[model samples]
Every structure is written in C-alpha cells, then in structure tokens.
Target chain A: MTVTPDQVLDCSGLACPMPILKTKKAIDSLQIGQILKMTATDPGSKSDIDAWTKKTGHELISYEQAGARYIFYIKKTK
Target chain B: MGETSKRLAIIAAHGSLDAAYPPFILATAAVAMEMECAIFFTFFGLEILKKGYADKLKIAPIGNPAMPVSIPNIVGVLPGMTSMATGMMNGWMRKAHVAKVSELLNIALESGVRFIGCQMTMDVMGYKKEDLIDGIEIGGAASFLEFAGENAITMAF
Candidate 1:
C-alpha cells in the first residue's frame, strides 16, 4: 500500500484505447522492475489492463478504485 | 507464451463514423497489447484513410436506430438528420473524452499498426496513393491474405 511509483500517468477522462495505450507507453519508459501508476476514468480499464498485463508479460502489481477513478500500479517485466 | 508475436489482421469495410472507430481502436489496442496489427481498408472503409476525412466522416441516422438520441426514422430521413446525428454523437464522444478518429489514426500509425489500403479497391474507387496519409502500403487481397494466413487473428469492422 505504501509503494511509490517510478512514473505516474494521469489518463483521467480518456476513453477506450487511450488508457491502456498511455499505460503501455508509460511502462515502456521504465527499466525492468520499475512501477507505473496510472489513473483513468474509463471503467473498461479493469479488464483491459488485466488482459494487457497478461498478454504483454507485464506485472500488475495492484490496483484500486477511488470514486470514479481506476488507479493501477503496473511493473515493467520485459 | 510463444516466440513469435501474434498478428491481428482487420478488414475495415464500412466508412461511416461509427464504422471507422473499431478497426483503428482495436488495432491500436492490439498493438498496445504487443500484437502485430494490420488493417486492410477496403470499399467504403477507404474513407478513413483519406486525408482530412476521418474527423469529418458523418454517421447517417436514416437507417440507424441506435442513434444515441433516438430520433424517429422519419426525422432521421430529413435533410439535416445526418449532420444532426453526427453532431450529437460527436458531442457524446467529446463529453466522454474519447479520442477523435483522427487521433486514433495517429496512434495506430505511431504504434506500428500496419495500414494496408486495398489496392484493388483503390483502383476501383480511383484513389491515388498520394491521397492517403504517409507510411501506408497499398496491397491487394492476396497480399492481405498472405499476412493473415500467418497464424494471425483476423477481424472485420
């Protein structure tokens, strides 16, 4: 719960591919094991991020919801 | 799980505003998921590749009952209904902060989504290669299928 991110991406208000797209870009800029904290308003990010992490071999460290926002902590694995 | 990156082959056959978003959106998202993606734009779908057309593409409400505002078919057939419906849809997309189709195109191209303008369709439609945005390949059905044949996941929109 106290983990800090290497980068924070604010994808609030963006829809569909934007959230996942921005999350991927942010994760790409990190070295292995670095964490990206991305926040988005798109409700679809839950499934999308899960699928993306599964497919891309990235690690979904954790995620939580705050009101209307979905926040994810993703770690770069490759 | 595999050594080769999976491929996605998409056939985009419709040119309406509603039709245009799927291929690019899916393509970009697929690319983000580390899939090798290509979209073959054919028939009316070519409208999406035309310069300056994506943002201006209109959705005709005349035959679309799914119009968010639910205008009756009679009113939908009226002269201004297409633009009205398109405007309302654009408003909704904007209100939800959806990226414009044009922006999606940029993302697709930048994310390495291969855009294949169907050469046969292009010849039939009389569209020159110069009319499309840069970094696109014009190929025929055989070429598209060649890529699609390589363990690629294919879809249409």
Candidate 2:
C-alpha cells in the first residue's frame, strides 16, 4: 500500500534524545495516517527511533542506511 | 489512530539536593520538546517539593568520594557547610550556563510537565497535602507506573 507524506524532519548531526525529541515534535503536528520522513546521523538513531516507534505505537514503515545517514519512514499510528 | 505523541516520566527518589537536578533537567528538556512529561517524586526526593524545605535544600557532600580534595571533609561535616557548598555550586552553574534546579522545575511546570508526589512517601515522612508545593499530585507507585507505561521514555534519579 502507498503511504501519504505529511512532513519531513531532517535531524542529521543531532545527538541522542534530540532526534527522538524532534521526531516527536514533528509527529505531533501531523494527523493520523500521515507519514513522516526522518533522517539522522546519530549511530543510535536506528535503535532509538525503532524503540520509540514501538513504545509510542507509531508505525516504522521503512529504515535503511545511506552511506553515513540513517533514513526512516514513520507513520502516525496513535 | 492519531499521531503518537512522545511522553516521558521521571522518577526522583534521591534525598540529596544535588541529585534532584538530573530528573528536573531531563523533565525540563522533555518539556522543551513539547512532549508530555511527568515527574514522580518519592522517598527523600519529596523534600524538594515540600514547601517548608524546598528553598532550604542543600547539596550534601558527606560520603561523596568524588568531592574535591580542596574542600576538607571536616568542613563538609560542619553545620551550614552543605548549604554553603550548594550556594557556591549554584553560582558556578549560573556562570557556566547550567540551569538551577528551581529554575528547571519552574520551566518544567510552565511547559506543562506534571509533578507528582508519592503518597506513601508523604505519609511516611508525615507530610500533609498542604506541606507539598501547590499543584503537586499525590499518588502511589501504581499510579506512576500507569503514567510511565504510556510514556516512551522513563527515567529514575
């Protein structure tokens, strides 16, 4: 299924908690079914975002590494 | 489902005044992110939320091995020493761009962070509801756990 884009959050170079915090702020501004594209450079971003998505009940549509950057697609679930 | 908002819960159980700073700092930062934040104060941590003791809180250096050797332990054992050290530390923090505990607490409250006092601890310490700061909610561990469960982040200090 195709997901609709809602917002994009570029969080590269941000350390632990900042990325998560910014992603959260972005998600809060979006409505249900909207998707967010998040990019970050923190080594812990992958696991932190994944865990955050799980705990917050958000849907992590996709995640992949592009060179040194980690990109994630998250959907507002609840 | 609607957008899942980030929420956080911080449990502060330390009796030492300096130790209380971490929980408030994290809570205030969480508030800055506009996340729903709650601080659960338990045990000696309740002192900071007590109206009578809050402003008089002092940083205890006794038994703290990391204490600078320049400050003699004997001096630390003297009356008013902890308060003097706390005041000096507060001044240094202000110079170093670090936020004070009271400032952080105020910011956290203004930013919508919930502050809760542990009911069990209050009873054990003989504190009535009037003894606590205004707007402080009284609850037990189960209540805090319920709030923490819905939060994406949980911290203990």
| Every candidate's lDDT | 0.90, 0.78
Model 1 Cα shift for residue B6 (angstroms): 0.8
Span of 10 residues, lowest total lDDT, candidate 2 chain B: B92-101
Candidate 1 off by > 4 Å: B1-5
Worst 10 residues of 1 chain A by lDDT: A20-29
Q: Estimate each model's TM-score.
A: 0.95, 0.62
DockQ comparisons of all candidates to the true complex: 0.91, 0.07
Tens-digit per-residue lDDT, A3-50, candidate 1:
899999999988998999988889888999999999988999999999
Q: Clashes in model 2: which pairs?
A: none
Q: Can you tell me which runs of candidate 2 are displaced by over 4 Å?
A: A1-78, B1-5, B72-75
Cα lDDT tens digits, model 1, B11-46, are 999999999999988999988888899999999998
Cα lDDT tens digits for candidate 2, B1-157: 6566588888899867678778876775566454778989999999898875654667766666675435777777998877777777667655644545666676667668889899999889999999887877899988788888884588788
Residue B57 displacement (Å), model 2: 1.7
